[model samples]
Target: MHRPRFLSGAIAVAAASLLTSACTTGSGSSADGGGAGGAQGGATVRLALTSDVTTFDPIRQQAASDYVVGRLMYETLVGQDDGGAIVPRLAGTWEQTPIGVTFTLKKGVTCSDGKPLTASQVAASLTRYRTISAGAAMTFGPGNTGAGTTITGDDKAGTVSIELAAPWGELLPGLANSTTGVVCSPGLTAGDRLGTGAVAGAGTGPYELVGAERGSAYELKLRKGYDAWPQYAAMPAGRPAGTLRVSVVRNESTLANQLQTGAVDFGAFTGPDAARFGKGGFRVEAAPLIRNFVAFNQREGHPGADPKIRRAVAQAIDANAFNKVFGGTGQVMTSYVDAKAPCVSTDPSLLTKTDPAAAKETLEGVKIKLVGSNAVGQGAGNTYVQEALRAAGADVQLTNADNGTWATQVMGNQGDWDLTVFPMIYGQLARGGVHFIGDEPADGRNFGAVDNKAFLAGYGAATTTVDQKAKCAAWQKAQKALLQAGDVVPLATVNVHYVFREGVSATIPAGAFDPVTLRIAE
Candidate 1:
């Protein structure tokens, strides 16, 4: 899924520099959409999309659209504000203890079935997610595959216990992941039927999924009397008047035409597509998306396994060359940690300025293959990387997979490709500090093979350290170690672009829009 930030599952190829415009909203209203519910009775917000949501099942879905749509149907136990602060969601209050963390469910919350949302359901759902979903490994602590982290529901106590392997950081952020949203046992117990069969889209969100035609359109109706959102006050608030119709239109030009003709009110655009928008009808806003990368393979026998070759690849390519691909619209990435994150750093070790001579010397006839999502940016990147490697004296080929297959193909290490332009589909990274570096490769999350004992040790210290400076220093050490290892290279963190009708107002975080807050102009 690099994400709907690029789909967000291993999900996308986006993130660049910013280009802001006039806009305002409690939930991110933009340039006077007649101030939220402007229509007399209500308004149906039409959203045009570039791709169908990869999956609707919170547990199995990893794409950015999945996360965005997931929020519309489900609610996270914790959610981040625009500034990325962790706030409560399904769980009203949470307290940490030496042994584990305890979360208290909010009272009176009900699923779409009108059944009371219970602590038992929440606990069982997490357990079920571990068993059925690939996201169990994405939860930031020792996952289901690892020892130590465990979940227990005490309905009598009216609380859910999230006991960690041992006080791991990112516990809050892990729970906050949209994939970790609470669901009733029926939804979870219903199995594959819940995701694809009749029971698909069942959840406890402010809106209920009414119908969906795969790769065509999705319809969501407001859950009337479901106005009590978990974090309404911190961000924008809105109750759309009518059903929300999400249209899947992969063609950029056709989608632009639709927006112009008023067929849809919103559309998230690619950089080039956005560049074509005139000043009047659409609102173009650019914000930090994600750190993009050309990740290398580090497992024992790959070309990237050779640190010199990895260094060569890193030094050979020019990230700035990609700016032209975005229509000279974004920043070239050079770090793993998002610059917008509170933990931003300027460590020199993470930087990758190209040196053709060094790259050529390192590669000098080495053979490799670069695989990427069939995105324009990835295609350009494949070209640029292939050219650079060829110039640096290596043999490389470019292959593009359907975007749906991209998220998994890069991670599967299926013995076909050697490198990828899109980095990992990441979320809530800073909280846990360095789990991504140490996650087991088999979990599918660990695409780059990193086995630095020093970094792993620093990751352990990061979990327990109370002081901010010590934690940052520990994280810095880990980052440097990974960079020096040559396999894990950092590139530009750029802004992702999305376009809205002149009157639509919405808030975006890391290239993801908060579906609950979307408001339409009359």
Candidate 2:
């Protein structure tokens, strides 16, 4: 996701320079109609979302929509405020030691099922995630292969202990993620049944899921008898305002039209639609999104296996051109970390810039195939890359892979393609390679299968380092190996834009991706 800036002459010119192709008005008040709620009992706030949510079960779902919906259904041990600081949620307070960290559960909290929330329940949830099948385990850590940490629960004392092999200063922040939301044992057993049809989790949140229809819509009702709502001392408006009715609309055009007609109070917009919204009187906001890049499948023994070929591909493509084509919404990143992250590299020279002559010389006799998803932006980006590589004197072919089969095809080496475009779904972690790239099976997201001892050593040092600067330096060294080796090419960091009505007021914090705060007015 890229930050949204006020449109300037330079930005407008940059956007106009990019290959580009490709709004509405409305007012009414029904849960089904697109207007502000009426001043009556049982009103619902409708939100039209862009992505479809795959699953309500947090442990098994990886989609951003799932995380957003999960926020409505479950409560994490900790949550980030509008300022991006870790604040109390399910857990009131926490303390850490060399061995592990302990969190004290808040008193008198109850799940949707009316069960008393306790540390035992939170520990049980974590244990279940660690022990469950592959899909579930992958949510908590690197992969679903094995559990590297242990969690203990003391119900009576209302405390949970998370033990790690090494010091994990980011443990609290990590736990604050939706994947670690506490769940009652019954809720776990019931699985996504409630998530599919009704509010399931025993959360202390303001709203509860009443009905969900997979890819269609999710209906959330006010949680009656809930007392742990955030205090709004200044405004004194009704908590949560009212029930939230979220609908998944895949078509950006239709979503824009709906928002304009007052069919939906809020909606998400991207690409060309962002500009359209700005011109149409809608408020557009941007958030930090996972960086998208074209990764050379090192596992595939082909031209990509050659460092020169990979470097050639990286040097040939113009990130600025690609971003321009895609509508200059994101930054061309050098490292995996988002610009707002503390671990981001400061040296601008580290980033790859367009160099056609250098690229041509490097790829003199190379022939490569580039694989990418059939998804919209991905396909466009891949085509631009293919053109760049062709211009650099390499024979490249573009091939399509469905999202579900993409990872499998790359891992199985079934295709003859030398490079594949893959989004670093894990964001900053993708660059750190702490859990994805190294000596161990867990060490490499380097799907290209390239392993350098020096890179692995640097990664190990970075993960164990306590000082922020030192850790950044160590990670920088590790990145240098990946960049220098050209195992994967860093492209532009994609920016996601959310469009809301004029009356709505919100801001996306620096590090967070989702735009949940948009629902809250100042």
Candidate 3:
């Protein structure tokens, strides 16, 4: 059966720019620390988090912390498995028509409050998110022209249909994003006062919010009747029979101590912690994520704008050296996008080898500034670049900022830095993802910019071409052309590692943590 298509090239490209965005939700919760929590089977799974979620409101949530909790409490229209295949959730099935896409809700789904999940509720939630979330607006919205989509609900038919004002290529993948979690009407304008009993956040997720203590901890209980995970038609005797207690174990020492004492069941580790956990008797589950890379500002007047200089820096930096600093947890990058992605280029030039001699000859007193965006937590990676550039006899300087500052200043500012570092969360096989380098939101983004013909041409076919096989081929060619241009240099593949004790196991996705599927080994 034909599935929903990806958005236009512009839609996917715009989405890529903000995937690592430092935008804040103002909920006042710190999410940058490690966590530990879980208990024995079917009792209570205790987790230590660096920070607890600030809000249960899905659309307004900006921190990864919020999604960890929100995802367990709410359900989206559809979801992807570990293999990246799209599966039905709240949406039983979907089909694309000339005007737009239509979705039929799964039968018998109900909210945590015991209200039936209605088509109108799902329809309103999608529209509300598009109106409130800037990121979602850019994805499903009209062509930068602001026309947007027309949405309608058929309660009797249990379906919702959406027609875009412009050419949209991917609808299912866009709606399946975490930001589009569906909720009842009352949830649309309700304040996110989670735990005060002021509002019981309603959704169709497996777990329900029992209560929470702001900044310290939160609790989740399996919904009595939630059967979303098909294997659990009749929940096993020990399944959906436990409470989840996630605490804010912010300090590294305390988190390590808790893991040793069995006070917590799981924790995500990086830097030294991951290496330490490897030998610390904990089972380390390493999931490959997109590599962090530097995008050289290729705009006119920028010192790195010259293609030759861009290639020079690409060959100077050592990808392995950057991974070594992360306690040997990362791998050298293989492509401009994540290696597992379909749209990634296979060109050998992508893995540019470090050549000090060549880089030195290419650079004659040419100095460039490298800006490190802390959103990806790869600050140490920037130092390696400075050392490599200096070794090649090129003058180099580094400026680092927390995500908030980096998001405000460097993301769109032209001629500010020769290089900037960030991660990629390529969606829809990176159809629009590979084309993000041009001026639009991807082009220095706050302005209108476009890419070369080869890149744009490939992206156009990949997104608009109806033949699926031909589309994939088009995306491959587009990515190759971009990598050959050397506008951006991918450094290394970073793994988001989760540490679990002997009795615990986790089912985390590539780019996200899945608290609901977290299980205690029998």
Candidate 4:
């Protein structure tokens, strides 16, 4: 979960980028099929990326753009399908054990370096990943860290076991995240170089990084005889593009324009530019990208420390009105988790209905500071929020910073802001629990300094339970606690639109497209 710019799970304004790690919805394909194998499959598929990746190290990736490149270069042990159900990838099969999960490797899977992918290498990678100060591993168990996890590999048995110090129902789904991508020994040896895009053959996916031009484009070529494709039921029966030229086109209009001119085979858009290709011709796959919500800082001396003030701020704004800013292409959220996440609450009582009169009465004369990431069209939403609070008689100040600054100041808890319309794409409740249930930031990425006993209790139950019905019930309780306490306000879910040229198609899950699922006609 990096700084979300649309597809990632950090924070975003709208459907900002393309492809979530594994979850997506809707299907878009072309009837014009390409010839079989060789030249056709050998053809280069030019795709569009809204931003450039800061690193190639999957473990250290922090933005949606980074995932765009990482997904193509790395493969996870297990994968989630369109329905967010666990499916096999590098691991041929897996089973839940008392402590954690054990996975048996698929015999033929090889690293990009053309060597056998050993369970020892996978175990070592996971071991190293757990030690990294920040990244998905921290959230994989939702909050468990190095002190609470262990990994072991048995090459003779072709198995790898991940044992958690505590019960975590999300162990499988967490491993499916792009950030948990298993790296080869070469990649682990590369160390810091992995973060700078200087290492190759560190991944176990279909493509290998061959060239990179920062802020411009990345070049990758398909691995010959690569056969570890995830057997997603809806995957188009076609070969992967022989070559991938991922061009960085930061503008939505430019990405849409490129799709129409045959300059790029595929690109995702979440703004007005999406309307340009909806009438036919281009293939389109759409999915709710991320759930945008309102979160308040509860640090002492802050306006948000009082639940009444937080509720008043929540009531001042309308989720429907906010959704309209993105052309009403998203669903109004009823809980902190996105609609796609398992155990997400659908209880309408969890939200406070718009009541400007009550809000104005409570918030009048209150001074507040609002912060947001300037990525995509987030500023427009920030302006709307500013005006809403101002109209409520509160002296509101809004600051829109670049994704980096916002993540550092706001997400890193270095700023003095009171509230934010935060957006994220975490695919599971447990995967995102770290944000709502701890005392300090180090405990659970609780940047707001939230201290909710009820929320933590509910979260504990949900993560500890293996029963689906019980888990969902516990999750609902957790969400209710957050909403009722005014700790977080659910808003809406923005949809990411993947528009593709004819003869090329891809499946979109949840927030983003799976690069391995990409199919191009020869």
Candidate 5:
């Protein structure tokens, strides 16, 4: 099952009332004068993080934190290599026939608890996810409904057959994500602890969960006898050097201070923090993130439903100004698909450019309310948007609304607001756009409530078509429909930056946006 990023309105509300606290006041060391694991045989690696991870269960929470933890605890049947190719992990090899695809399970593998890993265990794990009662089931088709996936196993041949109702060309790449990680059979009956803030599972990875405290920290120990240990050939020493400790230290200054004082070995830094860290002797790395965009609410009668008003809003704001305030940290995206994506459109003619006069003419005499989060950088661009609309002769009011209430207001079309700002972390598969905007019964990610018939039909065609070139055309066409309808405004792609101490090293894998696998120099 695919999991989209989770956003809570309450989070926005909390951010609005957020007080900037002094995170670096105390000494860098813990009260014990050692990191969470204490000094091990060689050295200990303690990663001090800034954000509070919402949950540890991969199936329950789709947060980046969960993916970070999953990278240590579980191994998917297939995974994305550093080069972004779909590579084998737990399953040694796989092949597809007219009937279905068969995955050959790696021999002599076992979970953290020593339970033998088999075709049945893998099948059972998938079956449990398909039958999850609490969260939304992972779907491969329209309406976000499960496509009746059936996993059949052969103990004699040590293989698993995944039978889909129709041919799913993107199946392997999709399975490389945490949404399809193998779970222990016993853990399947225990219920998902995602919302409860607990981490309990027997997985097949190089590390085992030692403990986790909600909103605080999580500890992991190197797993012995792990069959997938060989997969870490690219990592330092081909294994985790020692036990790793990840702490939640949300303040960027505190994280930087800790890194300098040797209290923490690694963390992410951007914006002012990036500049500060670079001047303070820390190693910084930057990477291109999938495109980010602001969605428009297109539910019936919503202001965004008016083509003229939508076009006016889109044309008014200067993306260059938004990038300036955003700190030149990422590139500006013109299309829904990432620049690196196959079959992406590169024609400049299709891109959105600022046109204040055109925007004003389109929005002449229109009055609209703009709502956004008051958190730092959350709604920095909304100000520019408001200014542009006003320049176009539209009466625009800016309001600080709690993020929680923002979606409901948009969905219900109750608030006088005509626009709001939301950001998305696009995945490699490019399925997020289709799932959130094209699928119905409206998912949390699909805050716009866009219901374009042409887009839906195009999305259906893209998913059903097995040909790669044809599928890309269909997907691009679907995106065009949304853009032409003014259902969403393309925004700049935000760059993700990570900062760490000199001795710390990590292999940040591709495909999974989560940054995990940091190790201290041996």
Candidate 6:
């Protein structure tokens, strides 16, 4: 089965969706004489994961679970702060040129193998990533994955330059994705082994993977001389733990209990268990996990192929009522992309409203196959969807499967479903355009077979400009077109809460934690 499509490009942007005590809250750096390693300091910071990572390769990571661990072991050229601003990572500084951007590598950067990192190596790694990521459903971030882009490096000048195929305004933000992590010579040569965790020394991040027990646990050790932390304007004053241990526990209750017992230092929770951490003096961070929505398989022979049926289905969904199903922990979404995305539609008039009378007249006796993923609280949400549709006189068949199987069936050529509740995590606004106007799934991301000419025109106009104002204006038009045609119906944005033990802290931006800002209070 293919990896689940949810959280395909898991980099998050800080917005109204993010709820935390502070953007940068930590204390103590390596230079503070605290020394390194859990043994030297106190005890290792333990993390809990709801699922095991799909792959160790940053380039192939498809789920949020992978990103949580992958970010520490792999370094990107740039990274996004809580406010979605681009920040330097491996590149100490950068400047935009006419065609693209140029970056200067930090002076003391080194790979896990203790070899110095060079601009030439970074260029080669980027080229490899572009070649491997072609025609894939997601590129981890926005902008084309260097399909026709040119990259060059000068080791003597300590510079790497990227010239895109076009004037894509979000190129820098796209580079912030962990998928662009530079692979060193050892990892580049390890081939498939590198992707499978069978090789080491291929990464240039702060931590290196040292041990793994498949579904049980994974261990990472901080590099001794690592000095490539991003220059955040403000942050807590401590360094990451010398040792980072990620434990995979499938049960949410078990994971929550462990946090209370002080067995785990950190864990992200989406369900009701999150409330337990709120009152315990644990540091908490909350951000939108995914935008829950529904889409029609507009291919011929499907009920959704008819415009009237599609409209009726859209009219039957009550976004506010759906939000309550998740215990009111989520925000109602106004567009295909979440509110965190730039230029999202804030006008409710553009969307279809709940009209039970009209929906009943149009959808009576209509047969519908409703598919959904069981991950996170999607099953309950899907149930809400099924009951609403049934009330409108549609014969709905609901199939809520495991995340992986659900993705394979929905995106495959099986034609097994008519409508689906899809929960998506977006990296850039342009990525959402791919879902509504692209080749069908198994080959492309548009599983719904959407064919809205207005949406296409608006999206095309947005891509032609690099100006933020013009681009966002065009995007507003594009999203309005999609909503009016009922191509995709957005429901709610779910929040994932990150809880840390009383004395532990880290800077979280866009919901993802910054490794360098981790601190344990003495």
For candidate 1, what is the lDDT? 0.60
TM-score of each: 0.80, 0.80, 0.83, 0.87, 0.81, 0.86
Worst 10 residues of 2 by lDDT: 1-10
Error of 4 at 311 (Å): 2.9
On lDDT, the candidate that comes out on top is 4
Q: Write the per-residue lDDT of candidate 1 for residues 220-249, one digit (tens) a residue.
A: 766645533545333433435356666655
Model 3 ranges off by over 4 Å:
2-41, 97-99, 141-147, 189-198, 230-238, 279-281, 349-351, 374-378, 425-450, 465-468
The root-mean-square deviation over C-alpha atoms between each candidate and the true structure, in angstroms, is 6.4, 7.5, 7.4, 5.8, 6.8, 6.2
User: Which of 1 and 6 is the better model by TM-score?
Assistant: 6
Report the Cα lDDT for residue 436, model 4: 72
lDDT of 2 by residue, 63-109 (tens): 55666666656777765433224556667667765345778876777
User: For residues 1-522, could you state the per-residue lDDT of candidate 3 as single tens digits?
Assistant: 434221101212222211110011112111111111122225566655555565677776655556666667778887654434456667767776433678887777788777788888888888777777766744473352244677788999999888777655555556666768787766665655432322554666766676778787667666655544422111112222256666665565566565667666566654355566766567776655546776766567766678788788888887778777665666666565555554455566545567878988887588888777554554677777777888888888887766556654455463367777655445344433533534544333522132556776776666554455776789777767666777567777667666766655545443445555555443
Model 2 residue 325 CA deviation (Å) reads 1.8
Q: Write the per-residue lDDT of candidate 5 for residues 250-351, one digit (tens) a residue.
A: 677776565667666565654465666665656666654434555665657667777777777888876667667678777666666455555455555655
Worst 10 residues of 4 by lDDT: 20-29
Model 6 residue 10 lDDT? 25
Whole-model lDDT values for every prediction: 0.60, 0.57, 0.59, 0.73, 0.57, 0.71
Residue-level lDDT tens digits of model 4 in 1-522:
111011113653232246421111123222122322222344566666666777888887766677767877888887776555677778878778435888899877888878889999999998887888366454446446757787899999999988777777777767777878888998999868888874666888778888889888777777777777665546664556767676666677766665677566666766778888875677666677666788888889999999999899889989899888878888888887677777788888778889999999999999999998766475677788889899999998899878778777777888778888776666567756678766554444888888889989998888776677888888888889888998887878777777776666665555557777677543
Of the two candidates 1 and 3, the one with more favorable TM-score, higher being better, is 3
Give the Cα error of residue 51 in candidate 3, in Å: 1.9
Position 243, candidate 6: lDDT: 67
How high is the lDDT of residue 393 in model 3?
A: 80
Candidate 3 residue 255 Cα shift, in angstroms, is 1.9
